[model samples]
Target: MANQEPRVLIAYGSKYGSTKEIAVHIGEVLNKAGCATTVCPAGEAATDLSAYDAAVLGGGLYAGRWHRDAVRLAHRARRSLRKRPVWLFSSGPLDPSASEREIPPVRGVRRIADRLDAEGHITFGGRLDESARGRIARMIVKSGKGGDFRDFGQITGWAQTIARDVAARTGASRGT
Candidate 1:
């Protein structure tokens, strides 16, 4: 068979559960692609790196920052990540009229990426729920500019690409 299914760990830091859903979806996509995938909340510091061959990390962005837990996971895994493939993603920018941007300018994020030699970093549009937000976020949603902005097509496409790359790496390592 293939090379042990190329274990992949998908960790996410989510607020109001959006980012967690995204991470789970990525795991599903990768699993369908024949990769063994594990999905977890980054805050848990769960998913031991020894069990995975590659990793993808994501978080919900608030005020130009990735969730603290997500940053912590990246740092915690830095040494192990250096020996494997790594990818990063952030969900942000609630305004539909706004130009969508991926990847926040957080120093911790960039530092982790550099340490791990990340494979890719993506930014995705986010979901804004008035009921789930605070005064400011709720006010912003009330201003007639809030909804789920995540692009599934783009997310899935990226996951598929990762599937290909991870599969290749595993196969190569197995001498396939």
Candidate 2:
């Protein structure tokens, strides 16, 4: 039998590209941990969920909602993904102080994740560049004391954990 390492797909949606960068970092961590990984935008990924041993979905949150593409993908693949391992993550909450608070998961996205029985869920801090944001987004960010609030260390550590978990599960399944 062939002993191929498990394949992991990191799919994400980003408004200003911060979430895309986070997905790329997660893909790198998974690759370093020995899993084959690919990172792509949720709207552009053409691979079927069944082809991957594990999947990570990340998106930017706007107005307490995850990106539309992320939500759509989750719902569309929920059944096929139920038997596989999945992780859900969001990039939002620009306030560094807000990071310490127990912010509830975004409602619509959380429902999809719950249905899939995802292995883990996380909400990381996001960035808001007023110069790059659209009119409404710019207004919102400016109104809220805008600043970049991403925590790279925390993101890296969580990604490592996901990689480890994927490796272990894939190993155990092969043994069985």
Candidate 3:
């Protein structure tokens, strides 16, 4: 793969579109770092990872559990994932705590990361708004607990690190 740009797939499972936005940002960062990236919802993600050199799987968190679609995708693509570098991320914290500290993956997410032998995992702040669906979401938003807490700077830095790691391993030149 020398001098070849790394192909990265970023798959996300989002209920209210917040997590999807984060996934897209990561894709943009990777792309700017010279990685060829594909971003898509986990449900719509391809089961085959053969076309990509690296993978990033992320999901929205609810009740301390990862989105069902993201979990299912991990299971479906476990074999392919193990053959390459994999990363995991979760977005669910309602406060700025995630931005202030390193929030570990929830239990189920940790297990999935372990199973996939992921290179890293991160938990970004979540977003809930009046437009969010579900009674609980609406309640949270109405109760004055809804807002976007994601830190794009952190997300971009993390993605850039991934890009550097991939480029180092593949011997590919990074974009200026």
Q: Which structure among the candidates has the greatest lDDT?
A: 3
Better of 1 and 2 by TM-score: 2
- Clash pairs, candidate 3, are none
Give the Å error, residue 82, model 1. Answer: 1.4
Question: Candidate 1, residues 92-144: lDDT per residue as tens digits?
Answer: 76754223444454666677677779998877877888776578778778897
Clashes of 3: 0
- Local error of candidate 2 at 157, Å? 0.8
lDDT tens readout by residue for model 2, 83-135? 78999999988788436754567788778878989887888998887765588
Q: For each candidate, how many residue pairs have backbone atoms clashing (under 3 Å)?
A: 1, 0, 0
What's the residue-level lDDT of 70 in candidate 1?
91
For model 1, the superposed segments whose C-alpha errors exceed 4 Å read 96-107, 172-176
Task: Write the number of the candidate with greater TM-score, choosing between 2 and 3.
Answer: 3
Error of 1 at 3 (Å): 3.9
Ranking by TM-score: 3, 2, 1
TM-score of 3: 0.97
lDDT of 1 at 175: 19
Q: Could you tell me the TM-score of candidate 1? A: 0.88
Model 3 lowest lDDT segment of ten: 167-176
Candidate 2: stretches off by over 4 Å: 1-3, 172-176
Among these predictions, the greatest TM-score belongs to: 3
